[model samples]
Target: MNRSEALSIVEPHLTKERFEHTVRVADTALTLAGLYGESQKKVEIASIFHDYAKYRPLDEMERWITTSYLPKDLLSYHHELWHGPVGSLLIDQEHGIKDEEIKSAVYCHTTGKANMSKLDMIVFVADYIEPGRDFPGLNEVRDMAEKDLLKTAWMVSRNTINYLIHKQTSIYPDTFHAYNDLTKQLYGGN
Candidate 1:
């Protein structure tokens, strides 16, 4: 779908602040797509729908996880992490967006998994580095983004883990997988 269509579909599902955040993420993802040679169309679609399920009720998200093929392990994690996986499924079910790349990008946007595609990295990093966000290590990740996408994603992964650990929340396994995979890709380690 086109940008306007995608935005319209997602806007009602999100809070006003989140809709604005989605727009920033779309703009940020497009910038990364331009730099990394990814398809701008895919980046835009993925970014627009990245938070499609963010405002879903906890019980509804839990039901989607249990009934759909989404990983059951998500139920054990904080409800905050459910949006990405639920959003991934809902986009296809509700909006007819069946693109696997877009689905995967949305699936792991919050806690990235191993073997991320260029499109996935674009959306993942774009969500984290979007201008409205303010995290401890955000500036450095934003700077690295223009220079190198992989390293920037790795930093985002690292920073996310660190922040979660500081808050003493349960860190999802896919998050660590993202960090480890990026580290291996960055430093040539197994």
Candidate 2:
């Protein structure tokens, strides 16, 4: 779908603040797509719908996780992480968006998994480094993004893990896998 059509579909599903955040993420993802040689259409659509299921009721998200092909382990983590995987499924079931690149980007946007594709890294890093967000060490991440995609993603994963550890919250295994995978790519193992 085109940008306008995609935005219209997602706007009603998001709060005002989140809609604005989604726009920022799309813009950022577009820039990264251009830099990283990814398909702008895929990146735009995935970024626009990244939060499609963000506001779904907790029970509904749980139902999607339990009934759909989504990983069951997500139920053990915070409800905050459910939206990405559920959004991936809903985009297909509800909107007929069957592109695996787009689906994978949306699915793993929140907690990235191991061996993330370039498109996945674009959406994932774009969401974190979007202008509206204000996290510690984010500027460094934003800076690194222009120079390197994989390293920037590793930084985002590292920062997320640190933040969750500081909050004493559960860390999703995929998140650690994202960090570890990127680490191995950037620094070859002995």
The residue pairs found clashing in candidate 2 are: none
Candidate 1 versus truth, CA RMSD in Å, comes to 0.7
Q: Tell me the deviation in Å of residue 156 in model 1.
A: 0.2
Off by over 4 Å in 1: none
Question: Candidate 2 lDDT, tens digit per residue, 53-128?
Answer: 9999999999999997888999999999999999999999999999999999999999999989999999999999
Question: Could you tell me the lDDT of residue 122 within candidate 2?
Answer: 96
Candidate 1 lDDT over residue span 36-69, tens digit each? 9999999999999999999999999999999999
TM-score of each: 0.98, 0.98
Q: Which stretches of candidate 2 lie over 4 Å from their true place?
A: none
Cα deviation in Å at residue 110, candidate 2? 0.6
Of candidate 2, the 10-residue stretch with the lowest lDDT total is 181-190
